[model samples]
Target: MKKLVKLIAILALVSLSQISVAGDPVEKKSEMKMDHAMGTMDESKMMEHLKIRQEEMLKMHDLSNKILAETDPNKKQALKDQQLELIKAEHIQMMSMHHPKMMKMDK
Candidate 1:
C-alpha cells in the first residue's frame, strides 16, 4: 500500500508535466485549463481517472491536429467546426475529471 501510493504520486507528477509540455497553442490552452481544474486532487484515487482521460485526450488532440494540419480550405473549415465540439468536451472533461475550475463564462 505504501509503495503503491508513492508510485501513484510520482506518476501524477509526471503526467502533469507531460500534459504541460506537449501541446501547441490551442492544445496548450486546453492543457492549462485541465491543470487548473485538477486543483488539489487526491493523489491516490485520481491516478486511474487521470490516466484514462489523458489517453483519451491524446487521441482527440491528435485527430484534431491532423485535420487542422491539412491544406484544404473547405475541409479545414469543416473540421474546425467539428473539432470545436471536441474542444468543449475536453474542457468539460477537464472540469468533471478533477474540479469545476476549467469552465469559464462567455461575455
Candidate 2:
C-alpha cells in the first residue's frame, strides 16, 4: 500500500510539472510578435550606433596621430593616458546604451 501511494505521488508531481511547463499558445504567439518588433527596432538603432561609432573612431585616429607626432616625452605620455581613458569611457557608454535596463539594474 505504501509503495502504491509513493508511485501515485510521483506521477502527480510529474503531471503537474508538465502542465506548468506547457505555455499557452496565444501568449506564445503574442510574445513572438512583440519580439519581432523589438528586433527590427534594435537593428535600426544598432546601425545608427555603428555609424556614430565610426565617426568617433575617425576623430580619435586623427587625435592619436597628433599625439604620436608630439616631441615632448611627458606631454606625449599624458596625451596617451588621456586617450586611453577616453576610449575606456566611450566603451562603457556604448555598453550601457545598448543594454540600458540591464545596466541600470547593475548599478
Candidate 3:
C-alpha cells in the first residue's frame, strides 16, 4: 500500500512538471497574435525585396554577357568597371532599405 502511494505521488509530480514545461497559455496566445501581424507585413516587404533583387540580377547578367563578348581590352575593362559600380549601388540600396540610419552615416 505504501509502495502504491509512492508510485502515484511520483506519477502526479511527473504530470505536473510536464504541464509547467508547456508554458503560459496567455503569453503564447499573445505571441501568436503578434507573429500573425508581423508575418503579413514581412510578406509584402519580402516580395518587394525579391523583385528588386531580380532586376539587379538581370542587369548584372546582361552586363556579364556584354563584358565576355567585348573583344577590345579597354571596352572590356570599362564594362567590368560599370558592373562593379552597379554592385556598389545595389549594396547601398539594400543597406538603405534595412538600415536607413547606417546609410546616412555612410554619406
Ranked by TM-score from best down, the candidates are 3, 2, 1
Clashes of each: 0, 0, 0
Better of 2 and 3 by TM-score: 3
User: Which of the predicted structures, 1 or 2, would earn the higher TM-score when compared with the native?
Assistant: 2
Tell me model 1's lDDT, rounded to 2 decimals.
0.51
**lDDT of prediction 3:** 0.52
Residues 1-107, candidate 1: write the lDDT tens digits: 65674465345434443232233334433433324455654564467446655765565555556664779988888876765555555555445445545444321
Per-residue lDDT of candidate 2, residues 64-101 (tens digit): 66675889999999877866665555545445545669
Best by TM-score: 3
Give residue 21's lDDT in candidate 2 (0 to 100): 15
> What local lDDT does model 3 show for residue 61?
61
Which stretches in model 1 have alpha-carbon errors above 4 Å?
1-44, 92-107
- Model 1 misses residue 38 by how many Å? 14
Which residue pairs in model 3 clash with each other? none
Cα lDDT for residue 69, candidate 1: 73
Candidate 3 stretches greater than 4 Å from native: 1-49
